[model samples]
Target: MVDDLVPIFALMIPIVAILSALVVRPWLRLKERQMQASSAATAEKAAQYAAQTERLEQRVRVLERIITDRGIAVADEIDRLRDDRTTDPRPLN
Candidate 1:
């Protein structure tokens, strides 16, 4: 009986190897495609964030220039605008 069981066990090894090959290969391919799609979405989001950051940086640079140039006053101008609003409640044309 033991001698008969040896052949069965030996036969099962190749069968198991073939079954796993059929199953694992397709599963690996599916995972690879999923990873590629995820990476593409991430790259798109990164590009959008970079563009938004650049626009914000440009606005900040413009503000800094206005503040540094002699033509603009921060606090006094704000007060003047506030006074104008109170004196003339009408919207400018």
Candidate 2:
């Protein structure tokens, strides 16, 4: 009886090891694929943010040029008041 049982135990060990290996291998592959997809998405988002930042910088440069062409002083108090008022706020003293 003991001799017969030893062969069966040996066969069972190999079968269990093979089954575990088969299950674990696919799980690792799926995890790796998920990580790769996430990295790709992050890269795409970063590229879009960079493009938007560049566009904003270009628009700021255009506004600076327009202000310069119009001879608007950067520190002029009267110009600041006029810009803040949608309608004339002149007071009669």
Candidate 3:
């Protein structure tokens, strides 16, 4: 009986290994794809946030320049911008 069981156990090992692999492989692949997709979405959001930050920084710089300047320079810059008809009227993105 022991001799007979040895061969059965040996056969069971390979069968169990193959069955576990078949079951786990698809789950691992799905998890990997989900992680990749999540990473891509995070990267996209980060890029958008970076762009928004840069735009805000530029606007803040322009505002600071206007506020720190003397009265005549500040007025001149506003007038110049108003007179530049070819430029886009909306500065904020």
Candidate 4:
């Protein structure tokens, strides 16, 4: 009975090892692929954010140029009027 069990145990060890190797090998490969895909997606989103930031920066520069051309004193007056509108507590009847 001991001899019979010894051969079965030896066979099972190799089989279990092979099965685990087979499963883990493919799982690792799939995980690597997922990582690569996620990295690409992240890079794409970063590029889009960079482009949006650049456009916003350009708009700010244009606004600054216009304000400077018009003069700070005039711009301040306009800002004061805008603030007045927001601060007015009176309801429009």
The best candidate by lDDT is 4
Could you list the CA RMSD of all candidates, in the order they appear?
Answer: 3.1, 5.8, 8.2, 4.6
User: In TM-score terms, which candidate is top?
Assistant: 1
Tell me the tens digit of each residue's lDDT in model 2 across 56-78.
99999998886787654654756
Rate residue 12 of model 4 by lDDT. 99
* Per-model TM-score versus the true fold: 0.80, 0.57, 0.66, 0.63
Ranking by lDDT: 4, 1, 3, 2
Residue 24 lDDT, candidate 2, scale 0-100: 84
Off by over 4 Å in 3: 1-5, 71-93
- Kindly list the per-residue Cα lDDT of model 4 for residues 1-93, writing each as its tens digit: 898899899999999999989998999999999999999999999999999999999999998888888887877989999999999999977
Residue 65 lDDT, candidate 3, scale 0-100: 82
How far in Å is the alpha carbon of 78 misplaced in model 1?
A: 1.5
* Per-residue lDDT of candidate 3, residues 1-93 (tens digit): 799999999999999999989998989999999999999999999999999999999999988887887668888888998888557676765
| Per-model CA lDDT versus the true structure | 0.92, 0.87, 0.90, 0.94
